[model samples]
Target: MSTTPTPAQEPAAQEPTTQERLAWMGRNSKKLILALVAMVIAAIVVTFSFSLFSSSSANPGNMVGTGTMAIENSKEGIAILTVDDMLPGDAATGTVEVTNVGDAAGDFQLASSDLVDTPATPPLSSVLNLVITDGATEVYNGPLASAGTIDLGTWQPDAKHTFTFTVTFAETAGNEYQDSQTTVDFTWDATQSTS
Candidate 1:
């Protein structure tokens, strides 16, 4: 008797449909994307950790110290110049000593604030003349209100410099400035020299 072949013995193979192919692709793509994300996150964490460790190691034993450079004025803080019952052509003179009390050499500059008049109507600084001298050497000569910054050169540690200031009132000043008084503030700034 002859035996018939079973369905399992068939040689022809059936191809996958479009839906099956699409489902397989979807599953594989999800696994691939998840693997890529995990790898990226791990790389970022490693890079950040490396940067933190390297930066901390680069500046090992770095320390900072606190110090200061100070300058002292002869007047302590402010210098008062008073001219009472003054007439035209009257003049006054004052002296100040500037010393570097710090441990470093420094360059100094002298500046003056704008002249302030008691009576705003008549400006007394207009007719006032100011002259600054360092040991007979002229440092500045002009109107008090118009004076700008003046370089006083450099001073070594524990060095001192004396300055003389002369104020004069113009003879051309009129009665408008009779009761008007003007005041000026002086500033001394010292900066550490590079050399």
Candidate 2:
């Protein structure tokens, strides 16, 4: 009879005991915690990334703008005072209406420039006297040569003032001032008020 080789039998598997299960679990606990931490971080990142698409808009009436400062006068291009063939003790008076036409308040001022005297010697401007008044308040009372810049005080928007200008040929003027004439240009200036 021919003898056949018999195959080796495999051993039967056995269930793990309670102590072995506990030990296995303790070893794998760190991996479980790490996996849970990673999952939570991913969730947080996704939540924050969704916020990037959020947006908002302002109201239609919400607007920004700027203010303007401007000034004007009634007698824009007219002469305030004129006297022809003026003699000693002669005077010429004129009235002008100055107004703050701008929407903002400002400081008002009066200045004189371009004084032309026919004869430099015994200049007529030296002997000519100027008296400026606003109501009862005298703004200036001096010779034309000494009148530099006069402050008319602060003015509000649309405010008006009537200024009286009286120019007199000094009575003391002698023959030296005869036939000598003086001309000056007056300027009205306005600057935005600080307050």
The TM-score values for the models, in the order shown, are: 0.64, 0.70
Candidate 2 clash pair list: none
Per-residue lDDT of 61-119 in model 1, one digit per residue for the tens? 88897555788888867673667787899999889888988888888898888668889
Clashing pairs in 1: none
- Candidate 2 lDDT, 40-157, residue by residue in tens: 9999999989987999987788778856566565677888888899998989998888888888888999998889888888799998899999777899999998888999989998
* Global Cα RMSD, each model: 12.8, 10.2
